[model samples]
Target: MLERIGITNFKAFACQDVDLAAFTLLTGLNSSGKSTVLQSLALLRQSHEAGLLDEADESGGFLLNGELVRLGTGQDVRHESYTEEDPDITLAVVKDEIRYAWRARYGREDDLLGLLEAPSGPTSWATRDLPSLFGHGFQYLKADRIVPDVSYPRSHDAAVRRSFLGARGEHTVNFLRAHQDDTITAKSLQLPEMPSTSLREATDYWMQRLCPGVNIETVGIHGTDTVRLSYGFGSGVSASNRYRPTNVGFGLTYALPIVVACVAAQPGSLILLENPEAHLHPQGQTWLAYLAVAAVSAGAQIVLETHSDHVLNGLRLAVKDGRIPASATAVHFFRRNGQTAEVISPSMGPDGMLSDWPKGFFDEWENSLEQLLD
Candidate 1:
């Protein structure tokens, strides 16, 4: 897991360090710099993968517009912040026993090419032994944009496993179908003398957990290339359901990819989500929170950016109910000044109580209520 992220001059953050927990919730008002944090990580990963930057490589620092990293005069770049002095960008992470720091300078080529530096550390700022953590280690999901649609192609490949559902969850059905047979067969084999009905029954049980009273089954049509998914609501009440991934309510499709991604993600993976509660009813938002907690317990670390009080309350409830360890999560709120943003982190206790409540935090609702009563 990433223990800390230090950013400077790379957006709304002039210079800041954020401590990360196993599950970190970033909540803030609009333009508070929540998305900028996620984007910086993404860009760093992209630069590393493309060889434009490296933890050890020097001379070639982050290049902008085909030149070395340069300072911008305005907020032309999303979440970007401009400053009078030369800008600097640094990201730090702790994995296993090693802590690594990647730093670069930002300015025009005509000004001066900045150096890329990595200092080693137990206490050192950079460690060369740190492995490049990439691949599905990070999964980003933006709300309302990740739902499925008709353009999605269904797949039944037996060789493929642990794939990300595209931005739009178009691949949801195909992914489920592909995993269905193996999952059922594996569970059945685990139980000695398990009846054939066991797999069928278990499948139904899991489906109902997501949508109560809903029945999900697969049917093969002789002439069709892909298997079809059908849904019903219990016995004696059956109807062929037609859902265009795009046409259905946004909540279902938006939430589906998250579920699939969590279950399919590997250990040591980082899942970055922006507003997982978007378009979800309050009840569904609570359910989403539960799913997120479960994912963390399963060994995936999540950094969530959200504005929903319901989502925060739900996670607190999960802690109180003992569904998740209170120490396993951290909540951070971003507040903006004229041009800079500061992060405030509050730890949650086992009883769903906060150790310290920062002023102005979660007070928007209270302020609105007061205004109404006044």
Candidate 2:
């Protein structure tokens, strides 16, 4: 697992070291650098996947655009008020006790920021010895995911071989179609209310948390390169009736990949999510946090960026209930300071009480209540 992340001259951060745990929640104000943390990891994963961080190679470096992330040119990523005259964007991850840092030169127009120095380590970053960010079970889901569509593309290589659901979860339908019958090995991720522990049934169980009695169907389109996803609503005593994705509301389709991603997580897996609360109702946000907690209990590490107070409370409840330890979780509140973003981390106690609640940290509910009572 990543113990901490060191980022300098990257986007909203000038030089900051963010501590991480099994499950880290990044919260706070809009555009205050919550997303920047996730982007830094995604950047390295995308860069490594492109073979830019190969051991002997020094010319190739961080790829600005790729499957995992599209960060645009160097100027777009470099901090607005970089401290140094020669801007060097650095990203480091501390796994175990070793710190692996990668420095790249800032190019005005170059998409590939050539390496300024090799990744700081005995061996290259991509070697099997180290805890790699680009592992088989890694997933990074952006906030803007696939919407309600008639069909989605089916990529066998992506869904089956690579086991990737795509950054926007574009391949989720195909992935579900392939792994529906696979048994979920994690007990924490299983749904006791459901009849079976298969991926499909378990997934339906979680989606029901978002919308009761909601079900999903994924199948290949005949003679086409795509797959179809439909929703079924369980009514009074009969079998659920099928409906197209368009007919169903957007929330179910939007939250499917999240359920799949959490359930499929195995030990040593790394999942990064941005705004899992997007399009979700209050209750759904809480349930989503439960699913994330379950993933952590199953041995996967999650770094989530969210703005929902409900999501924060759910995680707190998880810690209180002993589903996860308070030490295993970290909550970071980010606030803007001029050109950079500053983070304040509040520790969770076993009773679900936070050690400190910064001024703007999930206090909107109380703030509004105070106004109404006055």
Task: Give candidates' CA RMSD values in order.
Answer: 6.4, 1.6
Worst 10 residues of 1 by lDDT: 65-74
Give a tens-digit lDDT track for model 1, residues 107-184.
433222243675533322221343224554456665545444444355543214535454344455566666555343
After TM-score superposition, what is the CA distance of residue 87 in candidate 1 from its true location, in Å?
2.2
Local error of candidate 1 at residue 211 (angstroms): 4.2
Worst 10 residues of 2 by lDDT: 123-132
- Could you estimate the TM-score for every candidate? 0.75, 0.97
Q: Count the backbone clashes (under 3 Å) in each candidate.
A: 6, 0
Off by over 4 Å in 1: 55-86, 105-115, 118-137, 153-162, 167-174, 182-211, 214-239, 372-374
lDDT of 2: 0.89
Candidate 2 to native Cα RMSD, angstroms: 1.6
Candidate 2: count the clashes.
Answer: 0
Q: What is each predicted model's overall lDDT from 0 to 1? A: 0.61, 0.89
